[model samples]
Target: MLRACAAAFIVAAGAGAALAQSQPPITMAINQSPWLNSFVAMVDEYEKETGNKVELDVTPFGGLLEKIRNSVRGAQGAYDIVNVNSLWLSEIYSGGFLAPLGDVQAGYGLPEGVLTYGDTTNWDAEAGTFAGGGALMGVPVNGNVQVLYYNTDIYAKLGLQPPKTWDELLANAQAIQNEGEAYGFVPRAARDSIVYNFTPYLFSHDAAFFRIAGSGKADVVVNSPEALKALETYVKLATESGPPGPGNIAQGELIQLLATGKGAQAIAVIAAWGQLEDPNASRVVGKIDAALLPAGPAGTVASSAGHWVAGIPRNVPPEKQKAALAFLDWFAAKERQVDYVRAGGVPVRGDITGADLGDDAAFRFIGAYSQNAQHAVMGLPFAQAAEASDAMALSLNRAVIGEMTPAQALNQAAADLAGVLERNGFAVTKLPDL
Candidate 1:
């Protein structure tokens, strides 16, 4: 759409084998989000260089999954590329709707230092492993991972350093809340975000929802003692330090709290770091920064990974698939990625980590992005992921609303998930109580 940005990609061309003349115009269906500016700029660069039109049919995030599924069921998919959230990989991978990028990568090859993020890339339908098994379903276009976002100015005012353990974190939050200056924390608790946002607590407590035992088997542990403790701590954080009506707090509300300088700290996705630094949209510009999530008594730190991967539809024409790969190849190169980050894109390339981003507060979150990605865990990595995650979400919403105690909520969620797994023909085991 913009021709001026083409200069950024002028010299970042791929080899001849990756390109072809007279390629048809391709459309990619993606969701509307903050990082979209970077992707749009890159595509603009591609159109200028190859003289092939690529349309980005931006859609809402809520229904993009169903739209992509519907598109791929027909003889010719509606779009050449589809944006897939890492959470939905199990369903997408199981349906075989996406073309395996690894098959074609031997030709032009992935740029050196590009990461595959196995949860988004490799998959094995038969083994129930969404993490990896040789087939590359997609390339991560967004490197979204959760991190602890804290008000740096507030911390300095209170003589607080970033906490290193859950106890220390709670003490710091309580101290900030005591000052009555701002909310000590803000939690994301909407049905869609709850499971993901709850994962760090679950994992750092050394608890889990389920663990794949073997092919088609899952051992459910969502009601374990460790899980109960994690849930109790989560409730404490939200009710004691978060905004009123924590159950209604989603991404939009949480962002509003941080951007308006009403929140002191919260664990949220690193992608939203851009909004907190936007001078036009935020009152706290240059006041917020990120740090590693505090560890639990188990001595582990965990963050949920919400990265979105881009994949070519199996039903699109061969030329379009080839063209999509070509775009991805150029898009993921280290040179282009550097420019992408400078333009507000999340860093997906391994090489982007540790590079100096200077004093720009807008790009400062890149450091946290690198740190969180290392400890990130896929919350639900199974074909029943969507169904089971929704179960967790509903229970979480109830807990924040005071409708259910943390233990009751978790137990019900565990049982509900096991039932869903069984209905889906997966053998399930409830972990023994301590």
Candidate 2:
């Protein structure tokens, strides 16, 4: 009887050891969107490969930010991973709520070039480093570029080719409006959409919200003549052919109008085209195509590139930190990046350009856009960027709705931006030469 009891105890101990080898379940929080679904699918594949279970917590964008801020402040570390925009890096890093990933990147054999973009040793190092150089804070998950999406059918009907410059775009807009079948162009003129859709124009004109005269210093430049010109053009386009209250339209409504063939073109994120192509979600599946945004007086076109950034929160257990890095290394691998592209997550790897994918029209369009992304511009850095962006958006909406002249709106926006920077303790300086 004693021998039999000992045998049972030994077996139970072995079972417990096996269970311990399995990864503890982890939960990730995300803003509710179609992208979240794609991420969940990738996590499911990761779970199967590593014997780990991951739970996803979906919340509205606004709510997600508040919850994350609260969780980090309380040192709760409720989430194992979080998705952050580049602009929020400063605020979050300043709070010492994120763990550095430099060692983790080294462990994973991440290439020098990949790290360079996010490395402090390179240009804009101050922007990439957190809290005065503690650790690498985040891994870029996906690439998003703003592009000009058009309905192929609509273009064919009007005998229109892609606009190569701002003048051409204006001409096309007028022609499309004259046809009286659909609006010529649509952009997010209202809410935050205007800021997101319009910044590329500013950059294309060699204008910036803040000009970096030195390595780590940037001066506000929103009131420059070039910026004023860009703003005026944006307002002109919306007033001439866009729908009523273009400044008030939601992104969803704007997209819906474009997808239903009520609009001819939109300056939109490339990922949005995927949403437009999903037969289950879009009615314009076969008719849409995209290209880079048109050039301006600066003789260059600009697109905005945004990526999903993953980072470890500070105060996580060391072992868990190791695990998180392991996961990120595996997730950011080139093979996995390709898989992510196949699975509808945009690829950020340099080697995995859109052209390298299959030769379908969708891939062709995405590839062209991705190739041009190397020159795309990023918005103002995260510190107080959101507030500044909101002010810009508000001013843009006023212009779009004819509530203010372009000059009046832009001047006010520049003043408002200056106030935001000042309130945040950043010094205000002259606008850039442009």
Best by TM-score: 1
Residue runs of model 1 more than 4 Å from their true location after superposition? 1-25, 50-53, 107-112, 116-118, 353-358
- Separate clash counts for every candidate: 0, 1
Tens digit of lDDT per residue, candidate 1, span 1-434? 22224334344555532463456787888888888877777777767767777788777799888889899888989989888888777788888898888655554445566665535577876776775454777777888888999998999999999998888888888999999999998999877788888999999999888888888888999999999999888999999987899999999899999999899999988878877887999998888889989899968988888888888888987778988887776678776677788766887776665455556556767677777777778777887788888877888789988999998898888888899889998888996543
Candidate number achieving the greatest lDDT relative to the actual structure: 1
**Which window of 10 residues has the lowest lDDT sum in candidate 2?**
1-10
Report how far off residue 114 is in candidate 1 (Å): 3.2
What C-alpha lDDT values do all the predictions have? 0.81, 0.67
TM-scores for all predictions: 0.90, 0.82
- Colliding residue pairs in candidate 2: 87-382
* Residue range 35-151, candidate 2, lDDT tens digits: 655555666566655666566677887787776777666656877677665556556766667776765345333432242223321122454322224355766666667778888
